[model samples]
Target chain A: MSESRLNVLKTYKLFVGGKFPRSESGRVYEVSDAKGNWLANAPLASRKDARDAVVAARKAFGGWSGATAYNRGQVLYRVAEMLEGRREQFVREVADAEGLSKSKAAAVVDSGIDRWVWYAGWTDKIGQIAGAANPVAGPYFNLSTTEPTGVVTVLAPQDSSFLGLISVLAPVIATGNTAVVVTSYEAPLPALSLAEVLATSDVPGGVVNVLSGKASEIAPHLAAHADVNAIDLTGADADLARELEVAAAENLKRVLRPAVTAEDWTAEPGTERLLAFLETKTVWHPIGV
Target chain B: MPQSIPQTVPAHGPDAAARLASMADVTASDAALRRFLHGLPGVDAVGLEGRAAMLGTRSIKTTAKAYAIDLAISMIDLTTLEGADTPGKVRALCAKGVSPDPTDRTTPRVAAICVYPDMVETAKAALAGSGVHVASVATAFPAGRAALPVKLADTADAVAAGADEIDMVIDRGAFLAGRYLSVFEEIKAVKQACAREDGSAAHLKVIFENGELSTYDNIRRASWLAMLAGADFIKTSTGKVAVNATPPGTLLMLEAVRDFRAATGVQVGVKPAGGIRTSKDAIKYLVMVNETLGEEWLTPEWFRFGASSLLNDLLMQRQKLSTGRYSGPDYVTVD
Candidate 1:
């Protein structure tokens, strides 16, 4: 073994069932930078891998959701801490993967970690802010708080791979939602590295499962899947967006249409984007007078 | 009992932007025509889910204009007629399009009576003295998945029943499969069917059912192909899909109708049907027509609504505006 290989930190694999496994197909598609330099081999996930990720997400949903919001907040902060340790590595991978300048990639990593920190603070509070007390005129005390919408299937954005992936997942799970997230078209490697960070970040198995494959192939399955409660299609073409909208209508699933735009990843799209995917399930204890 | 062969509509290359540009010029060439059309505006906005527009100056005043609306608005495909008690209901529905109110001012009338080939004669008798036309949806209605000869005969039957117009559905299955020219040829054959019996050939309006195609671009492409293949009108929806008569979709079709007139001098009408429930929706559609197709196409004879409940609201709103009080349910009676 060369000194470089020895000194080089390890790369991660696809996260399924809490363990990192090379794609079951044993197929890896190489992603390259603009200059054609090889970056890393990303998993060319098969349909089987997609299905496996779904199973893992379903399994982890109950316990993670049943936990107190305070406990969930600590786990989310752990992810931010682990991410802070890998800042330099992330900057290089994402910059090369996104073809952004080095400074932009570093900024994206910083924003991504910031995203984790921001949501970490929200785990215990989003429910209060989102859910409402209904003014039921004649009936009992009617209070509704936000609850996880359940196992959401997300098609992560193609450009802002790491930050976009983290932005979507952190908000979702901040309110206790589990996810089967599909990695982007060009930048799947950094997403897998984040999955490694997640595996060790004290988050329970299956809170978030990352799948790497063609958006066309994997996204349709998730959208049409009956078991999946909702789909966040934030990285698709117009045709794809319409198709998924139609398919989702078969069961009236909540659908988030893909944004047909490019932008700086770190910029805030505002709190609505975070508030949108969560269904506040407000619970209140009556005080006896 | 089947008289002809099964038919197919050949799909062709769809260049929506180019087609829209060409369809824009179908009305008149000179600057005078543009000035005249532009100067006249619609009476109200079309709040139809897809507030749509059409082509042709004198859109409201021509004998030719009525001919187009009779052909365009009076189509009811079997997709609507599949209800177990359809033929009679379809007849009533077709007649409703042409029915006018005594108190209406600047209120345009629908041109033709539309129905299934099975009920074309029924519509003919119901609208005999009304000067309204009889039209039928042939070639399998909403799906448009049959063979050529069968659709041709279906068109022939409706015409034989005194149909003044024949509207057919393109094989969306074929279009999605990249069979564009085939869809074009199928439309041509149906147009031919309109002329098959004795010397009486109905005007042909091909229903692209824009909802199925989805994008404004695809809608434009389909509208162009239908017009090029001799469609008298390109319609918005079958009232079947969730997304229908979107304002954006109508804006695109209006542009196409305008350009088609410039290219072919074949002025076309626009019909946005399905889910047009309120008076506010009707106004939005009128606005779209005024802005896109100009003043002439605003007449009932040139522009029509394949609507079930829109007429009542249009009347009610007109009544409210004319009289300070709200009109009662009996204000506009339906037979």
Candidate 2:
């Protein structure tokens, strides 16, 4: 009998500039399962890669933000639809990355899809809830509205690789912000695969760039990037977060602090993530022509 | 392969212009222009883009960044080329060009103010003593499809209206159909049209409309053709096409100027007009210019950005660098 061929494992690459490219640094680190079994090699993104991601995100910000809320909502919904179609692949990847049972992994994947849908629905409505007109004393009309805070750098939650990543990322883009996400260090395969879904979806290129590397190695460069408008520190540890916060202060970046503890990935998430990357603009126009 | 750069070529001399006009044997006939251009090297798109991407990573920092920012601001050809551009709008743009940041008079003025032929007089009047030149786009502009006489008239009108520089677009149809000499002669005619009776001429910028040509080889050939026809500068686009100036496209043009200088002893400026809208993007172009052609091409006379929104972003970033705080669009005027 002929010998059977070995399965071809895929190499997880970084997503930037709307294309999938291996890290410019040409370095890849071994990614394994929770049980220490080999999975694949993930691209070890460098500071240059972080800078490139910021460029991509900044380029994408104009089109994504200028897109009507309805259009953005449909694009987000398209992401959820694409994710639903690739359900089994994510289930397998998540199960391997986190050492969860197949059923639990499937549940995590389902929650991620549902979380996209939830954010997708909020795209058109977030503005109405957050924007308002005020009664000013002078002969002037004053109104306030929320605008995307340009490019946002997101450090995905290190533990709940899939669900937590979508939780932090979906809200940023749904509200018209483009993100450069640093995927989980230990469990990066799922986040990498999610990048595939994002590409297939209607989401514009550079709207959500995924980098698979150590957050410690990549997050600091992004935190200090003058082009990056804000950063979410959900995936960082105390010391790294503290360092990033200090660097973020250099540009007055709107930082979302890390949660106190790793929360249940399936638990309810509020509007705080959506509000995290939004900048409010109040306009005053004269009442008379 | 692109030609290797030589160590030094004497600066383009008076006779070099006569020699440059003589270097092309095929100038008199259509087939010769075709043969010469077709014989030129082909560009590997992937390789060209890779070089541009690599050069874009130079980390221009702190003091270097501040210097680059100011240098970039001074290099801007503050442009407003819309069908809806009125006298008031042109005047406003001219004012902004003279004093980029009203709050800070110390800010360096822009290199020039770019406008249409009809608005050239207004821009020139507004920028009379400011040392800011008025650059007018002619030669049927966005689309170089009009008859030669009309295109020449457009050039003469702008030059007569006190325009110091005339930006013209080449006919892409003639270029794409491989009629290289026709394209060359048209640029020559426009160059002649830019000359005034007083023996001085407005500097000529030839726009290749790189997006329309759709190939790097064509852009390279067009660049040489324009240079041989006595173009003072070669621009990448008119800012009207869907794919205006890009890093790779501009890099290719920069390489052409570098090589043209090596071959003919003539130096031509490069303007990557359109879609470059931030302080960072401007710096990257500067990086490309610095690394590809070196610091000799870093001055406003040698390099220019044909953009409008780019000025505000540069000003805002300049404010941030100076005051240590980010300035919003509110702080800058909305010209």
Candidate 3:
């Protein structure tokens, strides 16, 4: 006969530059479950946190974008493998966050893992689908290639914590762009847990920085940051999205406007998100005799 | 502290000659020089490092940050010391020093432009009448392994080419081997070479290469020795080594200069040359200078940052302040 012991709670922190650090401002807000039970204290990231995430993402853009597409695909596939191993923890987190039954949460978690694998397969093939050779009327070879548009700031959907988050985040990194993700403000636990899986799955540090805070608080800074090359406003409300879009115009950043309706996370995701953060570069070579 | 020493001994005068003669009495003998340097109070490594780390945590923001950025911009010794350096590069660096941010006309000019001895003439020519002094690194530079005569010739060449400042390196081997008088004598000889026909000498900045010294005590000793030998400024590193211009090392040197001024009315400048890149780091150093030596040493005449990349960072930060948005490397000119 043994006595019951107290449970050791995990301290959740923001993942930046592939390391877990507390918010630089030392602010945290309470995140509750769908039933209004306090789950944990998530870092209330400030503009400084967003600034630091942009720096990290910019620093990582060179190496991750320079790697062979096949290598990136392998790394993304490895993330899927790591996600498979942590399926139970994510299932529990999703169940509490989305107010679903264990079976339903497990189904969502499985779909998220499959979504990662689907993007992993797309990493190598995205270049061929997006780039081409030009038929110029000259004695020269003109070819167009795709390049990762430096650093991207991603706003993970507010309501769908796991599956929807993966559907938006995987395509950004799969195409070689490093991402600074602002996780779901109400339910950041699943996204933060996914950061752990990304860390162990052979993805390089700074490649995917996850900040758990309000999109409204952090998005405006990232949108206006000169170092950030693009912005995806999937998590922002209409007013916030419009404000971010206006701010993003300062740098002429590529902006992916938020969908008009709630996106279906379980449906097939097209190449729209994959091609959003890529820049096409064309080069000309003389045809020597 | 030792007895109050005399102020700077000018060249070619009866009173100045007497002052110079008296100054030589401190380094009159090798044993006396060693005794005087070792007699200075030993530095407490842990306490010094603790104070430096504490000073580094001060949060400077808004108006204070803006003022500090401008002050820091004016104190930079815009340097480009490489074997691959060209006249074109030196001219460009001088132009950049004249106006750090071409977009913002309000941005302050740097204190000087530092280049290799060969590029001094080009830099001086480009910076003619710009009010930004041209500084040349001489005395065999990062490695002061050459003979004393060769070192003096190097200093003389730069001074003859119209360099306003001569940044010379001390023989770290001699300093490490306990040959204090030889190193002191070498510095004095270089100071002699800095003299011009009109009795105005190019300001002599002595490099101690604190990374190779390996202890704070040695850095303190080196600071006193260089000041005693008439160094217009004492620099921390050549920026060639692995560890250059750390907070503790810079703080210790600043303390030495503050005490040196108290002991003797003669004030020497302090320059931490290497690895200080970001504006935040530049501000931390400014905070250290303001706290350690007060506002008097906060000017460009007493302190300088020997950097190349630091200018762009400061410019970027300057833009960030005015525009209310962060700036990037793409916004600043390529060095």
Candidate 4:
């Protein structure tokens, strides 16, 4: 049997608890490839899975965030390492997920891995680079640093699943923030495989969580979730992006709109990603010395 | 307690083209219109300056002395210390208290003294309580491409130094990229920062730099945007561009102010600055304002011209109009 046909025959399942398992809800739906070919019977993620994903995300946050910047960098870099080992699996998965050729898929996968390495190094250096000491009139010495904005819930882009997922996750996790990314609706298999790669890599569980389901069902929950400190709707459709932008305003959550460009997303300055995930914290300590 | 707009005709209509034509006729050969009306048995413009009619207050302030009579010095432009060159020339003008003409001392002084931001305190001290105000341009003046916080700080520092009016340039790149809301919000935020040290906002005039926008539609849109975004005034340009204040620009901006007042009842002043080097150019702007916005907006309270050499010509014109004998530089008062 051909590899794609053989792969499609395997019942698609949710990746959680460090393994791929049928959703506790036990419901399945046929998801099609971009060409309308039946790919697999993927799990129709339920609210329970979403709640469970949050649990996983919250549980993983402390250790992932508290780890030294160097350790987190090491973890992210390891994700690159594992993906390199399973390159063929990803090439087929990305091709089916985004309706691209195997060569194109391989190129995207390579770019995704490189993006992680680039962001991994940023975890340790972002603070010292963008912040400074303010010259206030009072006696307090004012110093500023950029901190990770906390749990960033991302709605990955509609197209370019693997690269979009990696681009969105890298910057968020690089700053010590945990993320729960909603997988592409029509083609989520590659996202599941990405989660598998992250699981085995040095990345601790919950630092990056992937959930596959209807974006309409998942976005409102993430946007309205008080536990999620920031949200990136770069993957959201027009209606969803607007709705998320409005919902995010309730708590004054820092929201980053989906990157809209026809050019190479990598060619743009990294500030668009870095600034979106960073929080400026100005500290004041009375100077008596 | 703001009242609804106090004018007839909807803000827009099917025949906007025709209405503009009628207004053109109403202002054309102004003398004939005035004459035909005065010839009426009961109608007259004579001795009718009462009724808040400040349009007659519209006059050009220039430096040239002696020409035709009735032409007045509406302002005395203080270009800069460099333009003034020697302190002797500046002290002479200051000592003269901005005399209207060498032949007479009865005419009032020009509206205000405009200069570089660094010289604001000096001008404020020099012109303090002398019925002349001090204005400064902020937000990096020409480009206005600074960070939001830094831009706000620059405005605050300028206002704290006694700049009664602040002229700022909007983020032109944002406007060009169709980021209207961002540009509007940025102007609003900067204007909010212009308040007194106690957090009370200062008077803000957003410079559209119409020369940069280069189109009537864009100028009109920018004017309305600035007005709606809480700008106290909408200025034409930064006075640095080649084609600063064209007749069409002033006309379009006046219509914007007119439409805004007809809708919101808030009267926003207009300043057609930049490249206004002659009294004639200055007077054309006044005429545009008088016709488009009507007479109520003609006072210095709602109108101004940012000119360096226009004031010299206006003064010389007023002297010639009064004395009928124009002379060299010695005939005019420096201060």
Candidate 5:
């Protein structure tokens, strides 16, 4: 009876604008496990795919950014809930992707879910912490509030596929900005799987677009894209990051430089990533007007 | 210019006029118009759509894409027909029409600026000396529910206001009710209304509002009917309707112009207005035109995109081509 059964395989596709699509270039690269066993073929997105993702992210920007902070918080929490239900699948994928043992993979998956929940809580609170009623030296009530900085292009961390990817992605969107995330090159399976979670979660389509491909190939286009408002270079290496920073300057895009040291995925996170994609808009109202 | 002279006769050699006049028997009466319109070859919906979709798949890239983008830019009838349109808005739209991308001087200007009858003077004044024509929609515009006299007065008012082109809407209710001669007579009447005192008439673009016509067969019949009634251009829709322009609908119109030219040698223009927003879609239409009507109809004179937002997408794509980076809306004007 066991001999007659065949194992079902999954097709990994790029998630752009809330739908799963193969690369417009129709190219896919082979992905393997830690021991070099072939796992699946992930779409090797082209510059065109990166462009399409920017368009999708821009289209989703108005609705997603206009959503109530409380509603956004609920959506992020819903992503965590979806991840909790798919814990076993993530554990398996993370185990295969990072060459970790099942127990360690399960722990990492749990951490990723916790990360989503953590950011979900920050959605409504980040503004209160970051914004203020400015004290001006005049008879005026000046208010400063934070706004989402439009479409953001995110490069997911390479080594820590599941936890690190979620760490960078959750905050960009949780704060209201839409994202075009380029998943880690070698271990894209976990990120592609996470896209399914985001889709099923209440996250609106285009709010977080996921493309699985070489970061070096896709990041440059996105970094230089005039439409992309900001870019997180966390997944890029030294040389690529330098080039991308220069490209991002053409349109004066907000650039999040990669850390000099290897990031500790398990460490308690800070509010830096959440603040990276937000802008402060100051309004001054005359006292008696 | 007399009403007795059928407007179907092109303003050209006597040979061309004689040829078109000979074919005028088709519109001699209601029965003749009905038989002629019905007698045209029936559209193979599957085959037409298949060909259009097949042509749409042609990959235009790099230098070719650059050329197509520029060509498409020149073909746009930058339109603003909102009820709340102000003089300021029309002037801004006129400035945009003159220099689509103010940042890039090389960007070709659009063919015309389309507006309503009341705003014709503002648009004409704003577009003066820019080489961009002011096109005013007449004949009660999007609905076309008014009487023939009111429609003609509307057309005459726009013409007096210095409009270079008059985009008139056909009586769709009459057409749908199989009153082909009435629609044909109305179009002929509007064509006469387009005449100016200087012996020059504004080019007449007849809108079918193909969405309301209900069938591909009707669209084909409408296309022929407009072309035969002396429409300088046959436009797809008014852009107010829910379904303005679709690929297959545009393809059918293109085929109509192509066949009309072959049959009568009066190469009428085709304008697929509304709902086309991206450079990729614009390039697809260019590819369709190149394949269907050949290179001759590729210019702004023969084909046009009746759009407002399409210009920005074309400009963005042009910037992407020049800089090798994707351009965004922030870089373009908000309009």
Candidate 6:
């Protein structure tokens, strides 16, 4: 029986609108370990797939952004809890994808879980830190508060796939901004597995869509998408980043350029990522009734 | 034995026979209705979905898209159905229906303003001379579990209150239990109740609540049943279910309407209510209508979208088309 049994390999597919779907283009690329042994075939998402993700993210934005800060915080913390339960699975996948030692991969997976918790706490308090009341000389009371900048397109960091992907993803969604994330090209299994965690973590469908494909092929379409309000170029090469930034200007999309190719993923992410995808909305009301 | 004979409908136009054959003997008895509906046709889920997916790829851009956008706006039955609906809210909705895009006066008024039964008078008062009809959802609405007398009274109240169109839900319990004649008789009763004492009757749109029906074949049967029982329009869902109007479901209804026209020479409209919130989704429905039912159903008189938030999205898209810039929610009224 053991000799006759076959291994049931997992099929990696695109996560869009909170469901797993084979790429619309019906294309897949071989995802292998650092030693060049095939692990699985990741869906080669097309421009149409990217556009569909934008539509999903946009659809999810209203409900997510309108959710109470307390609710959003609880959902984000739940993601951390779910990630902790699957620590061993991610650690092994990370080790195989990045050719890291078991212990090192375990450390990376732990940090990813910790990062989620870190961003989770920010969900409730980010508004307080970002909003302000201005003293106007006139009889009008003015206040400025932060609002999510609609749908955002993110490029996950290439190296340290698990920790880096979480580092970029948790912040954008922490502030109620829906994200369409492009997973690491070389190491997509961990990201695809992460989508499963998100689905069960009380996160609404389409709030965090993950596509596994070449960032070079998918980023341009997202950047030029009129519906996409912002783009993160952390994983793109210099040429790709420059081209994407130009395309993003078509709809005046807020572009988050990478400061360095290999920033420390385990380092503390301040308000930079959170602030990048938030719009400051100011309201004025008359003081006298 | 008399029940075995096929029922014939008077030919109001030249092509009436084509429509009656499928509906013929359908209302004769339990067995005949079952056989007629079962024998109508079997829906290939994969093929039906494949066709819908293929039609979704047609790109209507530039002038054609602008034309479709306006035409779609006119076909909207701007709806607001909540447990907390108030007269104030109904008036506000009716006002929005009349002037969808306040920034541009050229925006066409919607086809109708849909509300609950009690708000029919309020909606009629607000939309008195706007040329926009007032549609009321009756027949115990959302769920049709009420007694037949109560359901008929509900329809009568809305019609008496000056509702121009009546949207009624069919009992899915009877439908699922294979009590096809009961469902058929219920629709006919409601159709009679829509008649006012003043020699005028409200147009009747039968709601299938297709989510509860849960199958393409059921949707097709429900469509034919409603049409044969005298439905002015066949609607997809009540917008209260987890799965409301979907592309494949709407496509199936469009096909039924098309076939109904080909068979009986009687033209019926199709409305896919619920969960349609974007201009793109609305345009896709329009495309389905244009492709399935052709140019005849393209007019507001033939097609209607039972949606609420879809109106604002259409307005925003219209603004983008004209101003060449994306408009935010702040620029539009929140109803």
lDDT per residue for candidate 6 within B1-335, as digits (tens), equals 15653443322222343555556676789888888898888999999999988888888887887898899899999999999999999999999999999889999999999999999999999999999999999999989999999999999999999999999999999999999999998998998898889766788999999999978999999998888887888999999989999999999999998887667667788899999998889998898988898897898888899999998889987986786545556568899
Candidate 4's error at A138, in angstroms?
5.4
How high is the lDDT of residue B105 in model 2?
83
Residue A167, model 4: lDDT of: 78
**Comparing 4 and 5 on TM-score, the stronger one:** 5
Model 5, span B1-335: residue lDDT tens: 46775544342223344556757889899999999999999999999889989999998998999999999999999999998899999999999999989888999999999999889999988988889998999999889999999999999999999999999999999999999999999998998898899887899999999899988999999999988888888999999999998889999999998888778867788999999999989999999999888998899888999999999989988998898888888888876
Please give the DockQ score of every candidate, comma-separated. 0.01, 0.07, 0.78, 0.00, 0.94, 0.08
Using DockQ as the measure, name the better of candidate 5 and candidate 6. 5
lDDT for each residue of candidate 1 in B1-335, tens digit (9 for 90 to 100): 14452121111112322443444443233343234333333323343223442321123333443333333323222123444646667666544555545555344455665567888777777777867776677887767777888888787888777887777888888766656667766887887777744654576767778778855556766776777666766778766678767666777788888876765455677777677766455556666677877887777545666665655655654554454333434467563
Compute the DockQ of candidate 1.
Answer: 0.01
Off by over 4 Å in 2: A1-3, A58-87, A102-150, A174-176, A275-289, B1-78, B88-110, B142-153, B168-199, B206-335
DockQ of 4: 0.00
Model 1, chain B only, scores a TM-score of 0.71
lDDT of 4 by residue, A1-289 (tens): 4755743266667766455667768877787877988777778777657656665676677887778888878888888889899989988888887788889888988888888788888878887787889999999999998877777888877676788777777888888888878888887888888887888887776777777888888777677555567888887887888997887776667998765664255453375787787889899999996
Runs of candidate 4 exceeding 4 Å displacement: A1-9, A17-21, A137-141, A260-266, B1-335
Of 5 and 6, the candidate ahead on TM-score is 5
DockQ of 3: 0.78
Cα distance off (Å), candidate 6, residue A63: 7.3
Best by DockQ: 5
**C-alpha lDDT (0 to 100) for residue A237 of candidate 1:** 76
Model 2: per-residue Cα lDDT over A1-289, one tens digit each: 2468777778789999789999999999999999999889999999878877887888898999999999999999988999999999999999999899999999999989999899999999998888889899999889899999999999999998899999999999999999999999999998989999999888899999999998998888788776788999999999999999998998788999998867776888888889888889999999886
User: lDDT per residue, candidate 3, A1-289, as tens digits?
Assistant: 2367766788899999999999999999998999999988988888888888888888888999999999999999999999999889999999999999999999999999999999999988988989998889998899998999889999999999999999999999999999999999999999999999888879999999999998887888899888889999999999999999999999999999999988998988989999999999999999899
Per-chain TM-score (chain B), model 3: 0.94
* lDDT (Cα atoms) of all candidates against the true structure: 0.69, 0.89, 0.91, 0.70, 0.92, 0.89
Relative to the true interface, what fraction of contacts does candidate 4 keep?
0.00
- Model 3 misplacement above 4 A: A1-3, B1-23
Each prediction's interface RMSD?
22.7, 6.2, 0.8, 37.3, 0.6, 5.4
Give the local distance difference test score of model 2: 0.89
**lDDT of model 1 at position B70:** 31
Residue A274, candidate 1: Cα error in Å is: 2.7
